[model samples]
Target: MLIAQITDLHVSFDPAFLDGRVAPLEAVLRAVAVLAALDPRPDAVLLTGDLAENGSAEEYAFIRHALGELDLPVFAVPGNHDSSPAMRTGLGSFMRASEASHACYVVDDFPLSLVGLDTSVAGKAHGALDPARLEWLEKVLGQRAGRPVFMFMHHPPFDTGIRTMDACGLLEGRERLAELIAWHGGVVGVVCGHVHRSIHTSVAGVPTVVAPSCAHQIALELRANAPLQYRLEPPAIALHRCEQGQMMVSHVRYIPDFPGPWRF
Candidate 1:
């Protein structure tokens, strides 16, 4: 099965300047077109939060209509920029009824079990998984014992080299998550977004990845005090392919036009 991962949409109701003077909605539309044109379309799309520029109902409504054009089932988790209540109301049809309170749910229709976790803090730029949420996740994982599980959340549990971004990453409860992964033999990997750059790392010996933003990208700097900024780097999407007896494979496909492939 193949899944398309799109993140950090930052969609706004009004046109606003982003990287290279491009509007956020334009970037999202372009990315959606690319997803629509994939040769072998993905079975489902995973949206790893930041679905809105501001946690407003209008923004959520705009994004809901835009996503509806894809005509594919979308699974989502709330990011720092998302409002859990707004998402539940605006995108209610796509969300699981059982997860109405929070954005966490187990997608049951897919071949592999997908557990979406909510990591957004109420009024903070950073993320956190409270004891209640952590306990809930433990119960969910236990129920689906031995099934290949793909965990999705908004904030990456580990820090990337980007210092400013790292400061705003998941602040607590990661150690608990690592413990869960250490014993849960069925967890294939963890997929998340927030850093705005595609990053690969490991947590508790489990493969972890952060998808790139479809709108603008965070500047790549590794110094101790690098300025927080965005750049017009080629936006991209992550394609995760899972087979019967093989490890999940991830590919980063840049969204730019190139020369024709003349039977390479």
Candidate 2:
């Protein structure tokens, strides 16, 4: 099974895109097009978070229409900039079936099970999962025991060494989450999207990936007290392919047209 991952779109309704030359919505559309043109289409698309710049109704609507171009199944969760209510209302039928209160859900139609955890905190940049949400995850994992689960969330559970982004990383309940993942041998990996750069690490012996944004990316700074900044780095997406015996392979693909496919 193959899963295509896109994250941190930051789509906006601003005509000039916050008075800048690049329009984020256009980048999102390009990403969708790239996904659509893949050699072997992915079984599903995982939209990690930060779908909108301001989490406004109009922004959600724009995202809804833009993502609609891809007919494949799309699973999503809210990011720091997303409004829970607005996403619930705007995404509507696009979201997988789940309890109404939280956006956490499961997509089991494919070979690999997808479990999305809502890490977005309303009006806050950091992420946290209260007891109730953790309980929900435990219950889901228990019920789906022995299945290869790909857990998706907006905030990464580990620090990226980028001081500014790590400052707003998953705050509370991270240790509990790590424990849950450690206990669940079936969890193939934990996928996230807040840092806006492709990063890889292991959490509880399971692979944890932070996919790059389809829009701009956070500057890569590995220093204490580094300034918070963004750069117009090449946009990217992640593709995960499940191999024999449940070994998952991931590739970071940049969405740029380069001269290629020429014979050696």
lDDT of each: 0.82, 0.85
Which regions in candidate 1 have their CA more than 4 angstroms from the true location? Answer: 17-20, 98-101, 257-264
Q: Hey, what RMSD does candidate 2 come out at? A: 4.4
What range of 10 consecutive residues in model 1 has the weakest lDDT sum? 255-264
Residue 170, candidate 1: how far off, in angstroms?
0.5
Q: Over the full model, what C-alpha lDDT does candidate 1 score relative to the true structure?
A: 0.82
RMSD of each: 4.6, 4.4
Clashing pairs in 2: none
Candidate 1 lDDT at 166 equals 86
Clashing pairs in 1: none
**TM-score leader:** 2
lDDT of 1 at 200: 93
Residue 187 accuracy (lDDT) in model 1: 79
Q: Write the per-residue lDDT of candidate 2 for residues 121-149, one digit (tens) a residue.
A: 77889999878889989998888888888
